[model samples]
Target: MADASAGRAGAAEEAGPSIRTLLLLAIPALLIGIASAVVLWLLDLVSGWLESAIWDGLPHAIGITSDNPWWILVVLTFTGFAVGLVVWLVPGHGGPDSATTGLSSPPPPIGTLPSIGIVVLISLAGGVSLGPENPIIAINGALAVAAFARFATKIPPLLIITLATSGTIGALFGTPVAAALVLTGTVAAVRNGGSLWDKLFLPVAAAAAGAETMHLLGGQTIAFHLPPYGTPNPIDFLTGLLVAAFSAGIGILAAFLFPYLHAGFHALRHPVLLTTAGGLLLGLLGIVGGPITLFKGLEQTGELLAHPGDYSAGMLAVFVIVKVVALLVAASSGFRGGRVFPAVFIGVAIGLLGHAVIPGIPLGLAVACGALGIVLVETRDGWIALFLGVALTGDLTLLSTLCVIVLPVWLLVTKAPHFEIEPKHGLARPPTALA
Candidate 1:
């Protein structure tokens, strides 16, 4: 027994990272962090430039107004054609289905990076109502793996993935803490013989580096100014609970509809035809919802929050409904992007409606709770949902209220199907005899 115990102890000690080893790992992690942030920044810049050229410059130079609905429709439909062509012609089928993917999935082959990057850039530039989180993470992960394999052969691919993802999360949210919060459940679930903090050391280092770099570069976060929550009251708590539950219910409804929508798009059976049709429909939705409802909802969300009084209850309701449909269309219609940004926009609209209806509830609480509800349903992570609520409001006061509201919301969605598409299964075809 003593020999066995000593042997186990020796194994544990060997498994633990030495200080010198940690320092070496931190150098590569920091480099990966900087590289990830730069890639994201470049994507944003390129997408913005392309979107401007397509949506504004082209129309202006051609003596047509982009404001006209017909122009918007034509451009988006053409965008569909372009993306469809790429997907059909490019190997790897334009990467995995975003509808079936999470924020981070297993990276595709290194060879697929170029095609995926092109499609994602086009989608972002063409006003697809999705964020770049998933593809950007995939790109960074793949690149990190390739680079490490070439030079640092001892680094495991899984560790590379974790570092890259952490860096990207930090860059995305403008804070290292966001990565830590998102990764907590994952790290805790691992049965590795180390303390939780010990396991988090490299990831946290990478995240901090990414976040600081983004900060230095003026990265955007989900920030908005809202009236403060003056005091904690039962009335406010009850209102938050009700509002969160209601928004969660809406998210659940979307969850139920997701598969049907995905199948409907896939039923077309070819990337070109399916995407073109999807684009035309998305263009129509853009017309109905106007410019605010068109894109991934990050800038539009800020715009909506900037002028809260400009919208009536009816108008706010329309915004919510239209954005939700647009999000569903974007996700289902072969457009590759993350759903969380649009979901945040929908949650904001819902909160605005709540405030409009019940003037008594604090606006900050209403918005935060609404975000908490929908984000919980969308991401299925309480920490993330709560973080989003607090981040969106730029108020620490919403934290406690949001934490409490998440409990009931989780219960409501615990057994529900996630916002993911199931992988299709089929037997492989036999090879034909050579001529």
Candidate 2:
């Protein structure tokens, strides 16, 4: 009995990866991580560059600073141009399926990368209320798969997939914790797929390597700081639950609007036309919402957190409406990016709404808290969303504690139907003469 136990321990110890194996996997993962960061950073840079060029050229554009009644026409026209180009020139660049694409899917993107990248950038830089995370992730996943297959002598298919998934973990939403949540979910999925516990090491290594690489390369993500808070009381719990209820509605709205907006612009399909039109709409809304609603809301989230009460009741209402409309316009118009940032923004709006309704709570904090709560509700990925909320507020205690409070309600929201889609292409055919 002693010998058997000893033998099992020996095997387990050996079965687990050593520092050496970690380094081996880390080397490749580091490369992939660096690549993801570079690509992400470049994508942002491109959007910034485009915005500057566009604005410089058209300073007097009517919709540039305010919502004109004709703003809808402008959005339609620009999107029509984009859709025309995508359908006419780009053969299979369907971009991404925002309407239906949810999280999770089968291995590796085979096609639909450049189109996705282009679309996201166009939307974000064109002053749309979105960020460039999700599309970038899918693209990164594809790149990792391609690289894995090219190197490593017949690396087991499962290992290749795990490695690819891991490569993006550290770079998840531009934070290590975000990467951990994503990779942890991925690991859960893999474990469920088969009795392949050994494969987890590969992804762990890849994620570590990727994160370390991002650190080395100075690929810092955008800054957000959630505030600190005291332990939740019944009041906090009830408030969070209420916010979750609203957030579920927000998620559904986001899901539906995301697709409808895409279809709206796709109806036109001209790049310049779609972009110009979307820009015009956003610009016009910017007139009332100010520049805050015109571009990706990432930069302004912090400002909102800092002075939530400064915004008037009328202004908050307009801000919420413009952001929702702008997200639809940008996402639907073939712009490339994720709606996560915009979703967070919506959460803030909801939080503010909550305080407004109640009349006694710290309205600014309430708005921020509600915003953070809704993120947990929408993504069904709590810790990272929690982190994002905290980061947004620049107050960790407040955000983290709020995260704890909101967790129960957010988990309840998991029962809500999420939007999901499969990859654009079907799997490769097996050999004709094969078994």
Clashes within 3 Å, all models in order: 0, 57
Candidate 2 TM-score, true structure as reference: 0.75
- How does each model score on lDDT? 0.83, 0.58
* Per-prediction TM-score: 0.94, 0.75
Best by lDDT: 1
Residue-level lDDT of model 2, residues 116-166, one tens digit each, is 766666565555676765666667766766776787655554455445445
Worst 10 residues of 1 by lDDT: 426-435
RMSD from true fold, candidate 2? 5.8
Instruction: Report how far residue 316 has shifted in candidate 1, in Å.
Output: 1.3
Which stretches of model 1 miss by more than 4 angstroms?
1-15, 425-435
Clashing pairs for predicted structure model 1, backbone only: none
> Can you give the lDDT of residue 127 in candidate 1?
77
- Can you write out model 1's per-residue Cα lDDT over 308-367, one digit (the tens) per residue? 889999988888887888788778888788888888999988888888888588989989
In model 2, which runs have C-alpha deviations exceeding 4 angstroms?
Answer: 1-19, 60-80, 102-112, 154-169, 192-222, 225-227, 230-234, 256-290, 328-335, 355-368, 421-435
Model 1: residue 263 alpha-carbon error in angstroms: 0.5
Candidate 1: lDDT of 154? Answer: 94
